[model samples]
Target chain A: AQSVAQPEDQVNVAEGNPLTVKCTYSVSGNPYLFWYVQYPNRGLQFLLKYITGDNLVKGSYGFEAEFNKSQTSFHLKKPSALVSDSALYFCAVRVGGFQKLVFGTGTRLLVSP
Target chain B: SQTIHQWPATLVQPVGSPLSLECTVEGTSNPNLYWYRQAAGRGLQLLFYSVGIGQISSEVPQNLSASRPQDRQFILSSKKLLLSDSGFYLCAWSVRGVAGGQETQYFGPGTRLLVL
Candidate 1:
């Protein structure tokens, strides 16, 4: 079975500092990875996805992710964090030829001003 | 432009009461619809998915059931609610066919369900 793991329960960072949210996935075949953000009492919003492309994929709200096939990781990154960037982040993986996605438990991001 | 909508933004029902949640999509045709439950604001568990009208695939077996009576309308229901059923329910849609599996899904605002 395909699965995604987000090791960190929460990550705290200062405003304007660089931030990283770790994500690792396991799949039988080619993996389609995605990053999503959720605010309190709101549905998830798609940030980005990695199907087949360059190692780096850029997303919304000045966020980006690096897909490292060797490491089996797709970590979300941002050069500078903002207070508004604080939210819950989830990593998902979809195996090739499947429409369903398996999601991680999610990591809470806390950006302090 | 495409948009997804889920009704009854917040619902509070008794444990034995019935449940019916509705979802609709606009500006798209023959889209794939999905129902997911998010427990404690964490990961999402896909409950059901429909590729077309009258076509429903259940991912998990629970107290809930889903039906797609129309091309863009999906419904989730249960004869009797359970305390464990309380969670945030989300509806999503993606373009069907032509990279459909690889397509990005757009979500609705979500509905918060509380069972007493």
Candidate 2:
């Protein structure tokens, strides 16, 4: 079974400041990673995904993620935070050939102005 | 263009009462359907998925059950609702059965169910 872990429960950053949310995964074969965001009472919106190659993956809302095979991590990054970017973020992983997006507990991001 | 629709945007039900949630896809055929639940402010939890009509896969077994009567219609049903069932129910569709890592799941707005 594939599983994902989000070490941080919440992340806080000031407006215009850079932010990062950590994610890691455990699976049997090569992995496919994804990041998604959810606003209050809304369904999750797809941000980006990493299938293979080019360790760094970029997504919507000026957010990006780096896939590190050695560290078994895929951390989401943004150079600047906006108040509207605050939301619950999720990291998901699936073994190659299997697209059942197993997700982590999720990390809450809060951008302060 | 393709879109998904879910009914009763919000539902309030009493415990032990029967429950049913419906989802339909438009402008698409033979879609792969899924039923997911998200606890308040949490990530998605896949409860059921279907590759084709009458072929349902259970990812988690609890008080929920799902059925696909048509190629584009999926339904989540429960004989008796429970408090644990209270959460945001989401319906999603993928182009086809997942084979490798390229599949993307498109989601509906979702239905918020509150079990009182």
Candidate 3:
């Protein structure tokens, strides 16, 4: 089955510290991975995506993700996290070229000061 | 630039009440429209998608129904609302097979439904 997995249910990070939210995938063909963040009572906002090419992809708000083909992972990362960065993050993936993204359970990030 | 709009930013309806949530896309033509629901802590669950006028595809089995009355307008309807239908409903759009796998779906602000 094609699915995305976020290993951690919640990630705790100190303000100004680097943060990482892990994600792994099980699919048939090349995976189109995407990351989305949701604030309280709001819709999801696009963060970054990994299609092909570069392994390290940068997204909005100084966030970046590394795509590891061998591990079938696309983990979201940020050099430094802010207290305002606390939100829920989701990892999504689709088949070779399907636009329908199957999302992971999601991981909540708590950046405390 | 394309934008999607969903109405009734928040709603509080009683169980068994009818529902009508609308979404419209501007600056795009023949786009793919989708309705997704997210529970308190659950990820998005795709409920319906429409490719064109009068064309609708359901992703899950539910009491809700969808219709594409026009090219850019999609409506989600339920004859009777259930407590299970309470959640954050989001409307999104993507260019139809335009960029292959790189297709990005833009979402609306979303409607928070509370059924009692």
Q: Using lDDT, give the best candidate's number.
A: 1
Question: How displaced is residue B102 in candidate 3, in Å?
Answer: 2.3
DockQ of 2: 0.64
Q: What is the interface RMSD of each candidate, in Å?
A: 1.7, 1.7, 1.7
Candidate 3 Cα misplacement greater than 4 A, ranges: none
Off by over 4 Å in 1: none
Worst 10 residues of 1 chain B by lDDT: B96-105
- Stretch of 10 with least lDDT, candidate 2 chain A: A92-101
DockQ, 0 to 1 scale, candidate 3: 0.67
Query: Per-residue lDDT of B32-82 in model 1, one digit per residue for the tens?
Result: 999999998897999999999999999988999999999999999999999
Q: Roughly what TM-score does model 1 have, to 2 decimal places? A: 0.98
* lDDT agreement with native, every candidate: 0.94, 0.90, 0.90
Q: Which CAPRI category fits model 1?
A: medium
Report the lDDT tens digits of candidate 3 across residue range A1-113: 68999999999999999999999999888888999998988778999999889999999999999999999999999999999999999999987554477889999999999
Model 2 regions lying over 4 Å from their true place: none
Superposed on the true chain A, the predicted chain A of model 1 yields a TM-score of: 0.98
